[model samples]
Target: MTVFILVSGVFTGAHVWEDAAARLAAAGAEVHAVALTGLGGPRDAAGAGIDLDTHIGDVLAVIDSVGVAAGREIVLVGHDYGIHPVLGAADRRAERIARIVYLDAGMPQDGVPALAAVLDQSLRARLAERAGAGGAGGLGGVEGADGELPPPARDEWQRWGSTAGVPEAALDRLTALASPQPLATLLQPLRLTGAAAAVPTTGVLCNGNGASIEMVQLRVGVGDPALQALTDPRVTFFELPTGHWPMLSCPAELAEVLLRAAAGEGHRLEPAGAAEPPVHLRPFLLDVPEVPRERAGNVDLYLPDAEGPWPAVVFVHGGPLPAEARPTPRDWPTFMGYARYAAGQGVVGVTLDHRLHDVADYERAAADVAAAVELVRADPRVDADRVALWFFSGGGPITADWLGAPPSWLRCLAATYPILAPLPNWGMVGSRFHPAAAVAEARALPIVLTRAGLEMPEIAATVEEFLAAAKDCGADVEVVDVPHGRHGFETLDPTDESREAVHHAMRSVLAHLTA
Candidate 1:
């Protein structure tokens, strides 16, 4: 297995992984220990720039190189603050990775960040008394026997960046680091809801008790259940004896566990170790879901922070079952993230549930999406000309054929792992479902149809047919197999390929919208 080792907390540098990586390599595994933008004791220009994305991209560049020669999946091990960029890297390279192993670091225990997780209950109360002095949140430490403790220097942010152990020399390395991290990583809520939930992760907790500090904090009622990274369904917990600086004390054990996980032979894997599943509190589900308001039908909308009101995209939830049959949150988070990403580049994202009629025609659902867009735009926050439409699975053809008819005011269209065959059972219906009609006013609009290996045969054929039709009518059409996801990737946990496909394609979508 290939392992990417990332240093997250305090003073980090890929140098830290030298020893651990050597051992893993001897065991026939590859490991890379990397530092984030600012914290690592490196001159910024001396190495790669320090922007979070640059760091993520740096890792991706390496993974891409190693992937060309690998046999199994890649395993990413991140420490502390490193999870963000490592995850970002994983999100963009979901296809290349087999699993993620977080050593002495993982997502927070609850709503509170990891900083809050490590501090014991009694220490927390004491810190609260000192809240006026910036408290624990400030990263300020009391003057110690070693001399004055470091105050939370605004530039030395404990918010966007963090550290656990660092020598004085590494502190000098920050002079040439890149710009500080964007606030979104901290203040922004990570919405792993619906079909877009992230890949599963394992946390190897090291510190005081065998229990993770996050778990300990939770038992004391100090955090929100959802914020805890441990709640992710793919999560498996293990304990190690050591402090937060495990690379310094227990590199061998961390490497062993990481190798085991990549080999899919971890001790507590599923039925091998029966226990309660992580209590998921996100908008999505732990099991098959039941929609509370079946008849009324609700739609979930995600807006980008940078875009106005929002340039909304409506997702027609795809399913083989009846619309009344629960579809859970559908693709809200995935669609939303893509939309918000576009919005950050200046667009909006919108998703809606459709009604399945007795006739079972899907255009009705398309019309419903069209109507939802109009309604969403009616709100001051939405922009009509900037509107885009997206769909997955069965919803794929629903929107494509729907667009065939009197095309609504969509500026662009994006379809992923779509199934595009025209059903004889569903009528021409002459509106959004009529492909011939939808292309009539197509002088300038752009259409992106993304096909993947696991895509349905008919859908691929239909998309091929649609591309010819669009080009004949003078519409812009780009068809590519960017996301190489497996069958049912829409439901399976995310992979690096999944993220790179979505993000890269989305950049195109957003750029077209703005241009």
Candidate 2:
């Protein structure tokens, strides 16, 4: 018999698992949902002394009460903020645990606190700043009176995770049952002795919250060491189509998934082989000759052989790329390929290194791009009056700056496989980076967009939204579609269609620049 121990995330407690627990019980598995020290009760009852260790004790107590002996196996399931305590307890009780399930939660590394896993970028930044400035034991100041962080307001619940597929009554119940979370739980780092590392693990990704098996695979394929670790044979994945709160939104499905996870039955991610280069470093599809290049600050200018004051195209690479990513975007084969290809076609191709290392660094990255453009135009070999800015991937949002107010010298704007709107999980509060909303201001400036047919659903939805907004405003936008192409198709899916799409996009941008 398998005994499943459940842990709820911040704001809720064991009660949050009632529906799922009943379903699991009916399926013949023993279920025990843990309500941590300071949660699932009145806010006043949660004392100031409650901390992460207290919650760890709470989980440990449950583990001790449910004896893992006599042919009984234990499967530990942690949801959201609950993963921190779950990991802590699992680390101590490694020998008794059969498997650990990370349900819509981040993989908490040793010495990293739960705060690092907070989904809200701005809030996380603020909290970190406060913690560094002597807030509360390096945790940060809490909004609640008794050293606890208050639960999100009803309308603002989306800040925590996506609410899609959750019924209205369930949401009301969730809000009502929400409890203040102890600040120390989020501040204190999780310590491990490497005991639980060998335990088989399962990840239940919530697709509605913008995490999926495909995204994980894509991240691993890029050679991210942290994510690459998940490719281990012992680690498996299962995706839920509902929102973050699967218990409230789809209890029966969640119960089934939990049961399968207990059985170690799920899809496995393929490890990135050491022999092959990462997707970004792969050879460019187009075999264009290398052009003469000169470095100016962080920007690289690829000059056409016959250039004497020629039109230029500034290619901006997409990111929120890992800070440790090698070769940088400027040195990546795709950017190099595009630059070289443009130079071969008689235009100066410009590529620059920007500081968009995190989602919040868009402003800084836009500044870097603007500064690079100014430097490029000042070059004697480039025509200052006719210039185009071509963006890719996550860099697409930076186009909002230019689209809202086009300069006379700016000839065209282009984006390929771009994220035109903030993803649901991004927690972007304002419309500052929303290109779809800004397209209305782009009256005469020519726009070129290249879309991949097999792009990620969330990203593709943004592109569709942008296209609709562009059409509504009658903006002069030309879309180039690659029917069977995926994101980063230039190198990842090097087919005839990909090549043609790349050429068509380049031709369109060049035409606008020369016109």
Q: What is the C-alpha lDDT of each candidate?
A: 0.50, 0.87
Candidate maximizing TM-score: 2
Query: Over the stretch 44-104, how does candidate 1's per-residue lDDT look in tens digits?
Result: 3222222345556666676777744556667777775566556666766776667777765
lDDT of 2 by residue, 372-461 (tens): 999988888789999999999999999999999999999999999998987766767564888999999999999999999998876887
Off by over 4 Å in 2: 42-45, 137-144
TM-score of model 2 vs. true structure: 0.93
Segments of candidate 1 deviating more than 4 angstroms: 1-297, 330-333, 336-346, 357-359, 400-402, 405-409, 424-441, 487-493
lDDT of 1 at 183: 21
